[model samples]
Target chain A: MKLKGVQQTNWIGVGIFVLIVLIFPFVVTQSFLLNHATFTGIYVIVSLGLGLLMGYAGQISLGQAAFYGVGAYATAIMTTTYGLSPWIGLIFSIAIAALLAYIMGYTMARLSGYYLAMATLAFGIIVHSVLVEWRSVTLGASGFYGIPSINIFGYTITQGIPYYYFVWAFAIIGIIICLNIVHSRVGRALRSIHDSEIASSAMGVETGKYKTQIFVLSAIFAGVAGWLFAHMSYSISPSSFTLDASIIFLAMVVLGGSSSVWGAVLGTVLITMIQVTVHTLGEQFTFITSEFEHVVYGLILVLVIIFMPRGLFPTISSWLNNKMSQRSSETQEKKAS
Target chain B: MLEVKNVTKTFGGVVANKDVSFSFEEGQIVGLIGPNGAGKSTMFNMISAIFPPSEGEIIFRKQRIDKMPTNAMAPLGISRTFQNLQVFKNMTVVENVMVGRHIRTKTGTLRAALKLPGTKKEEVSAYDKAMEYIQFVGLQDLYDHLAGNLALGKLRLLELARALATEPKLLLLDEIAAGLNHKETKEMSNLIEKIRNNGTTVFVVEHDMDLVMSICDKIIVLDQGEKIAEGTPREIQSNQRVITAYLGAEVEKNAQ
Candidate 1:
């Protein structure tokens, strides 16, 4: 009982995606490449959550990295200090993030545009400050170390190859769940609210309730992604999850299509690849400084906003679909006439 | 039936609706007409539960509904089209209508997440109903068009279709004829009558005196948040207070 035309295509795409991800590790043996792919997967999961909140739900959040940091810190603290299992820490992290998100969302949901953005920005900054100032527990600016590797059912994912599979598996699961939510009634309600809050309310969509639910759900996803990252990296610093990281996450949402799930994945992969490549080039080329990379990134962001406001995925997909449909309609009309 | 009793709404110190009382019976087309600042739209807002009246009570289907949120009022079979055409601009015409059907849906979020049988069936039915309303409003040709791209007249039609898609027992229309051409206004008035004929009461706030005079079963005139006259359209047309409040005392004297 799926939506007839698009549903079949989506399932086919998912199948091909599963196949590609499953075979990816075999093709790439380099540790750096594997590590990059794992990081991409983690970002993809978090970005997909952000995309759902911003793109479909019409919310602007600059606090995603805060939730991500919360998850990572919670998992790290739970595993190291409490001597708990990483898996248990993962669950606890998601719960804590969701609880915090629920409280924040209740207050933040009523705000729109610049106000909402500012509130979330403040939240990310606050989280980053806490991580730095709380020295005894968090180890402050030096960052936390000795985070134990994740063990799933007696399988220790300590190295690149095993960890790559683990992160990607979680990413694929995250993508599937996000896809389901996007196509569901909840997604429709969100889109409605995004378009016109008053109209959606008049239609009996409890706007506040739905907003909070999506916010909390997105936080949980970010938390889970953080847990994966913390365990895989075996180290995390407050600097890694700052307001700048939150902006990067938001950039991924905008660079991909905000409303599309695959856009989140594509955006994460492209941005990470670009960052890694540019950093590598900076080491070789004397002129290619960190400042130059920042300039380039800023320029690209401006260009995307001006020309492809819907993001790369939506623009490409719509263009391709438009051409295909045009050909089909022409053929059908020719036959009819 | 919908009843508004001694409803008073004040925005800060300014009174928008003061001691206004009215009731609409089932299967009736009631025209709420007033000049500028007569509080017609404010009274409509109060009836639709957009904001609670500062004083007094609103009863719909024999239930006190003034305290309910606007979102919660849709399930009780009350729906409204906004004065400025509040169609979901990002959505297609059909999707805008489908949102109206959301209240009737029995699917829980978890069930929707899992794509359960209940949600699947409900989704299909909701789409079908949306299509029906789109056709009812004569917008079937533009069913898949994004509401934002539609012309002003079409957007109004889309808003009406969306409100109708809720399967409402009573529909409130605020300035539905405000921007329409003469022909479009006539068509709108006829369509509203047809909707009323289909066992739904219609309460419309209109500035078009011609449409109100021709189509309304009963007319309620307000002046500065006070009910000046309530009767058949002919009675309202001849009412001295309504003429004085609407057309000025000089115009009323000339008419007499």
Candidate 2:
């Protein structure tokens, strides 16, 4: 309610993103590149949710990838073993994630700062351990395979251009939904929670309740990404849902600017691109090591922490927005002269 | 009307407020005057429901509010400004006031996410309401300025505007004139009177005797966690106990 939304011009960024999402698959013909791009969309969805939690609500979650794994497993088990529809699996994935988060959200959110981070990290470790130990249902460490490709209205979309278009559609929708929340009363409440929890309570905002709500929502986002990942990859493993993956998602949020939605997507794309790029160049840097991808990512993460600690997306985007406004004013002056 | 009955608040062995009992009728600018660590803020905190009193009952509008949560007070027609400045550092001036209207606002997260018609309508009205308070406190020029960027005096005015936006029946202001210049204090005194005249009961705690004596219809004095005197401005000015409490027996020595 009484929340007056952030009145910044957000539509311009939204417009550019919609255009790019529509034309991106058509222009990019290489299947290898297209595959990585598709994965980027999935990461974008998760990171945007993380950005909302980390940036606005001022809640840190290190178990987001655990939810992602849950979504993937839900899809992998429901469709392959239970013989259910892929759509149902996707929905179940989100539901399961939300239910798990709802149970622990309030207790964990009430513990601020380092306690919150450690709580989430412990949750991630537990989830990952379950995925490894529970062999009967999840296939354990051996992983689940032969997941059916997603199908819509008699069109079986496989591992090429169609899959790219399909997954990016969800990313585009996720971005728009995120933007809507960011500029509305929800965003104001979240930002207020971050600003001062005491003042927010004084203003009638139940800080704990709002924190729990956002935590559940962010978990669902990661779950949705996990669902898409299972169907697209046709297999699943516990390693993808580990604490390291969660840290990378956090890195994505920080590098892109946690408060900015587009920043989340940009950060995901940048990190994913670097991973793909460096994997190829590992042979070239033979003197250094075979695990060059880790070296490159670690370096970038450190640089981001040091030089652009506030986040690159928010800083750069605000600067660009200012420049645009200034040029427009200059143009008006020129016309007057 | 508001009643604080035998309220005693203690943290461990230290009693911050001890057996403090006082009440203010509707539409009165009541001042709670005390020296530092004299339990004025402790009283305000108890009445505002920041924490439950260790021993006492607080009645607001005939309902016992001693057990209510801090957030539950605003909706029960009670609001307060903090002794320490508590403006949302991330929000604009108007946005801070809008947050004060949180209790009255009824939109759900889903409706806000979808940009439904009711949410849109409420948002516009909330903006208008926030702006009205911003102008009331004479911060229309800095309506869009980030609250963290404002001066201490301006922030105090912003807090007043925010509390007023809640439209509380009983408003507790803890040191509303603290850190303000003479002119600013004068304006604040006038605003407090205006707020009282508008039908909201005003409860203020302050060390500024000049401002307190000029505006307060009734005054209560606290010394070392105990209420020493309660009367009108003239009675409080002449009370032997009040003088002895403030001047600490030095006045009684002169009188002897």
Candidate 3:
């Protein structure tokens, strides 16, 4: 009974997700929905990493898409050119991304706020340019094509349903790992550093080391997601993993609330759904164009930043709890009268 | 025991401390009295390993600690409170103290992540220690309050509690009695004495002459980055150079 409340809520969330994932193929029966779900799962993985970095650690990283791209490009090159297994490439992607993250984090951890953001933004742009200009490796503007689908135990997951299960498996693992990290000692240190780096360091926390570790860990998560993305789509493009994509990932983290891992999943799912729906609507109504989606996104970001800076989950959860408490109070008052 | 040998620190061309050498025996409350810009805080910072001294050695229980980083120094049983009050504002009062105990925590990041049996036990112990420290600082009632929301006096107490939670062998208190009423200063002086009685050597940098004179077993005076005098409080009160440099001729004449 002590854990009954938490268990009930968790079960409710898990049940809804299970129903949706199971019934979605039957209801839609379209390749578009399957694609959207795959993309949504990828975003979920990346957003979870971003959430841990920005929300918990209080480090705004604009270079996560760069790491994501790094994973994709690394896997693409290894698999296509060297004929390496995608699984091996996935491990290497994490290593390379983690190494890059360590260097960047060490340099940028000392910088604060806008300066830190600018540093990461510059890094993202540099990576994007490298992807565009590196002809032999990334295939430049022609893009890397014919990435082999993920193969597990000699079974090629070439279809949407199989790929959906793969993406969901990794997404769930990523979420669980992030949640565990959030409640750990490192998590406490990250929160303290976010509040005041000086105070944290003075309290005998190796502030710089912890920040760098989190940065690298988050990058590894992003890299894993990128690996999944490349394998799922069976294609890679420089355009998809641009600075704009990085911004979209950040928006997902902020919109869903950076404070909780569940927020990351909710945010990714919500944003992906909106994007798919908007694209469909744009096809029907010529006036509702793809360009307008950015405007809508910008407006939503502004509203969230202004009204609910703690993010959607904390805000919504508190409101619901408050209403429940009020209703209970009213019932008690009536019984007493 | 704590010893600083020929500690010299310079910020670019400006010399902050020059050949500052002193020793504090265990169980003694030593007062470092200095005028503004007297390198009192600079010395404290160096001793606490916030920054390495330009040329010198810091020996704590005969172990050189000058090369150690601030974080590592805590586990070496050295702790300090900032002059500006470096309490973690976003954390609760108890959590602020828990940060001090972080070095002693046996739980690894992985164990903490998994919420394993070892980590859970450590967590319970840490909470208990934090509560004990809160009570030690007479902040039991406000243990749940955010440190930033507390009053200035309470914040000072919180900083003291946090530092104490490190279970330090040597405590460096920078301007602990700087902004307090007469009664509060007296209480703080008593608290410093209590801290000393608990087997922790204390080095306090304070401007309140009355509190310093009453609490300190020995007094070291600095003026413009140099040690002007070092002796008993009565001897320091009578020293002509200390009078001229700090209290002035008028105060010396009044004392006579």
Candidate 4:
């Protein structure tokens, strides 16, 4: 539906964002840089799902990587063990991830705020342990391999330039879906539930139903991201799907902006860049380790929470809005005089 | 028509509502009034299915709904505003009201994501309906404003409009005019009357004596979780029991 005064939406900011997504690969030529870019796209997809729970439904989840792992492993086991297409594996991924989410989200039907955060944290750890201990299926902690490259429309994306575009294409679709939801009745109900569960229930919004639905939807997004990452990396270990990855996903959503859809993408890009930078520095310095990456992420998360609590996109967007409006008003005055 | 038959609610050792039995005929502006700790809100909550009664049953349109969940209350033609405004602060005024139209609309997550044919049409109609109520509440100019930014009177009006958008058969106003000044209270009274005239049964829980007396066709009074008196406004005005309940008279009032 069209909001009456929605014509005043910041189109310039939207255009700039579009430009960034489009030119990112062309701007960054190195394969190492391109790999980070690909990861950014995947993280954006997963974090956008988190945004649905965190931003819209007002539920925080730290178990996204479990869903991500479920999706990736589904892709790995189905194609490698059962001899199935990754696309078919993709369908199984969604189904399994949805099942996992429903089973886990059942506990969250009445949970909220920090209690929910803890539940999801515990759930993430449980899924991580399963991924590790399930030696029969997951191939144990040795990490599964021989995962085939992703084939989109009869073509393989080797993560060169085509894979970058491929990952981003899905990211763009994820963005569109997130945007469409926030403008729809479903989005409104989730937001209303977030504002006040009592009032939403009073208004005949099945708050629990919406909460569970968003939880499942968020899992599906993480599953899909996990699908992409599994095929692209040709490998996925328990370490990749641990609580650290889940926390990183949460950090991206927070650092981007809580409720802003673009904030998901922005936050993912910023965090991914940070990861790449730290990894690059670690490679150069012999003593420095990947452990150093966690410290950087921790510092950034704390700083963002303290300073830009609402995240960068909303704050920066508002600043841009003020600047644009002030300039236009000044021009209008000049023309009148 | 709605009936509360011998409903009793106990919170731990405290009885919030005891054997509260009454019925409202269709199309009447009914008021539930009482002093502090009178269990007026507790009664409203039970009726709205915020919680089930400890004993007794509530029949809405002749269906037993004592166990229905709170969200089910709206679709069953029972919608209510809160004692405190619960308008979504992050949403625009129109969006806040649109949340009420949720039960009426049928756009699921997949359909909403795809923007299917029925979804957009339903959305447009919902938008038009939300606007009509926004205008009805005399808030047409602030339709796009954030609901939290509106003045107190307008916020109350927004809640009413949101409740109305549910297309309810019975509308419950919980202290709808609680914090308004005299002029705003009068406007709220008129709005309640207009809603009643528009064919939705209006049941108001209020402490504003003048506002309640001026608009309500029937007044039901509660005190200490029991039904104290039930009568027309004129009868309630002169009722000795009500007077004693309000003024703390030493002697018991004669019941006629």
The candidate 3 chain A region of ten consecutive residues with least summed lDDT is A1-10
Candidate 2 lDDT, A211-308, residue by residue in tens: 78878888999999999999998888898999989988998888898877877888998889888767666657766463665676678779988988
- Model 2 spans > 4 angstroms off: A1-5, A287-290, A318-337
lDDT for position A261 in model 3: 77
Indicate whether candidate 3 or candidate 4 has the larger TM-score: 4
Largest lDDT belongs to which candidate? 4
Q: What is the per-residue lDDT of model 4 for residues A124-222, given as tens digits with 9 covering 90 to 100?
A: 899889889999999899878889887768888886788878888888788778777777888889888888788899888888777888889899999
DockQ, all candidates in order:
0.54, 0.51, 0.30, 0.66
Candidate 2 residue lDDT tens string, B99-204: 8877778766667656678777877787888898889889999988889999999999999999999899999899989899999999999899889989999999
Clash pairs, candidate 3, are: none
Q: Which runs of model 1 end up more than 4 angstroms from their true locations? A: A1-9, A329-337, B12-14, B181-187
For residues A264-283, what per-residue lDDT tens digits would candidate 3 score against the true structure? 88878888877888899999
TM-score of chain B of each: 0.96, 0.98, 0.95, 0.96
Q: Write the per-residue lDDT of candidate 1 for residues A1-337, one digit (tens) a residue.
A: 5532112128889889989888888998787888898899999989989998888777888989999999999999999888899989988889999999988888876665666567778989999999999998998988888999877788788777788888888888888877777766677788888888888888888888887788888899899998988888789999889887898898888888797889888888888988888888999998887777567667777889999999999999989989999999999999999
Query: What docking grade does candidate 1 earn?
Result: medium
Fnat per candidate, as a fraction, reads: 0.56, 0.43, 0.38, 0.70
Model 1 score (lDDT): 0.86
Candidate 4 chain A: worst-modelled 10 consecutive residues by lDDT: A1-10
- What local lDDT score does residue B55 receive in model 4, on the 0 to 100 scale? 98
lDDT tens readout by residue for model 1, B196-241: 9999999999999999999899999999988989999999988888
TM-score of each: 0.93, 0.94, 0.86, 0.95
Which structure is stronger by DockQ: 1 or 4? 4
